[model samples]
Target: MSMDVTFLGTGSAYPSPCRGASAVVFRTEGDCWLFDCGEGTQTQFMKSPLKAGRITKIFITHLHGDHMFGLPGFLCTVSLQCGSNPTKQCVDIYGPVGLRDFVQRSLDISHSQLVFQYRVHELLPSHDQCPEGEFKDFLSLRRENSVDPEDQGRTIYENLEEGSYELVADEQFTVKAFKLFHRVPSFGFVIEERGRPGKLNMEKIKELGIQPGPICGKLKLGATVILDNGQKVSPCDVLGDPIPGRKVCILGDCSGIVAVGGAKLCYDADILIHEATLDDSQMDKAIERGHSTPKMAAEFSNLCRAKKLILTHFSQRYKPQELVTDGDEDITVLKTQAQSCVLFGQDVTLAEDFMTINIPIKKNN
Candidate 1:
């Protein structure tokens, strides 16, 4: 497992008494990224340990109200916090086309003055005739009709491995988006960390008479060093295998993973957060409505070789487990139905509001 993923909301379509909407936060020491911003998300931040002010990037899977209606309000709230305390930061957002207009219009209508700078990068569908890297500024939306969110066959990730749809990539990690089939144009996101340096063998270093200096540091950087005694020391002699990066997939409400094609982006993910909105008994209706059942989610997780599968975006009919204290975790029916579909004992977790999963880094020897 990895570090932390907190569910700010888990309900589908709308906010319920037990759940907010569709929102999740992935956080590390000095950064925070929000997956969705449903209504009351700011209030959810107040209730959870996640601070609202630290959101530097936001990824919206679609234009649905439940998935992004709160974005404008949350942005306003964050701006208010900064205005009062005087902190300067920028918020970068990514989503399907028309999202920028919606946000700008909402902000304009409300006249909410923000103390920070925020930019929305819209992901255009593959069929768009517009050339790559030549998209005019979002202000161009003012002169055109709204791009339909449910335009059939609309998708931004036609080629996942081309590295063209990357949203964030830095020294530590990368974030990319892939298409999803849904009632509305939807997407799934993957967060991948760069490989880390292998652990050093202290005993071997001591045996080689290597002191804690630039020599050891260069070895960690996979460079061979020659000692003052004219002996050659190789990195392989002291360093274990490099640690593979973690890959996490967070998806939007969808009927299924699209038809197989080029290399699958979600293959072998460390954690997969998928929407299992209905029970197996409602399989027919689930797909008709552009949703998935526990069995569907479990099968997808297995197909992708995901180490951990988290099922979320539950239907309102699935009430809390009887006599449960705060909320349902380890839901019985979901587990029972999904267990059969998950091969090789892949971990399955039923998501609840405020549920947090701590994942550890993968180690290699």
Candidate 2:
């Protein structure tokens, strides 16, 4: 299976003529997971090949308007789509405290009814304070309350006062959330795909006088088979080494260095999607506003030894080619500066609206 990331909006704070605000979609296994839904994000979705209805989960970075203003509208659109089709699809939203209330208030005030049910999993600092293995039980509590109609929306916040819950876990992949250092409560997400079994060595099998038949299938399943000549063969004897999985780290708006937990979450990531809302010369301004500059983003990528870096959330002041009169350079200069800070020969690219990057599976050597 292939995993692809689509940048819906790449600008920061506000929408510009060439860029919108913060939003990206991670598509895999025919499901779409959205990160940040700033203003005009729904419109951007309409422009791209992605369907808003395919978005099963949304991870909001923070409560900032630039990061979440389009949420209510997008929810309404999805509700309308589900209403027309009458499906039993449910959308799960994960974010900091007040997210559920903000979404509920928006729907309530507009008197809009959703055809499909949606759940909001709020991440609290108390959850971060819990002991390591304790969060599993806390997550189980949240899951239990999900079935109760009265407790559906408010259960996670009310019941889990001192623990955090798992964002996502399945056979194919797992997603973990870590707190980010920002002006308000924020989060970063790390997605790790499960390692796949080794491939059957067809050349070796042919060498062993095995034909392309049921025995090959059995060998692929890690079974031992005996040939008609009484030769026993195990899968490990013919199979190659297992293929390692891919790691993707998507971070939210934050200052210079990520939190220790966040850094660990990003370690050795195949791709690092980070916010570069300011130029190198604006370090003080970035610190004051709790945002990262391009150089800082590059440095963070280096610290994590990320194989690829994609920078987003650019300030509106940066045009495609024009230099700023206030000492800030254009996007090209920013990209160049960020590349300089990255480890030698690593891939680094700036994210543009509607750009799609495919993460191909690596073959075992």
- Best by TM-score, which number? 1
Candidate number achieving the greatest lDDT relative to the actual structure: 1
Which pairs of residues have clashing backbones in candidate 2? Answer: 127-163, 127-164
- Please give the distance, in angstroms, between residue 156's alpha carbon in candidate 1 and its true position after superposition: 7.7
lDDT of 2 by residue, 1-365 (tens): 88989999999898766898899999997678999999888899999999998898898987789999999999998877767676757788887766777887789899988888788877764333223333222232333333564434433332133122357888887887776666665677888888877988889998899998899989887789999889999989888998878898888888843346567667888889999888888889886777888789898888888889999999887767753567445887678889989885669889999999999897775
Model 1: runs farther than 4 Å from truth?
A: 127-164, 259-263, 323-331
lDDT scores in order: 0.81, 0.79
TM-score of each: 0.86, 0.84
Clash pairs (backbone) in predicted model 1: 1-359, 1-360, 2-359, 2-360
lDDT of prediction 2: 0.79
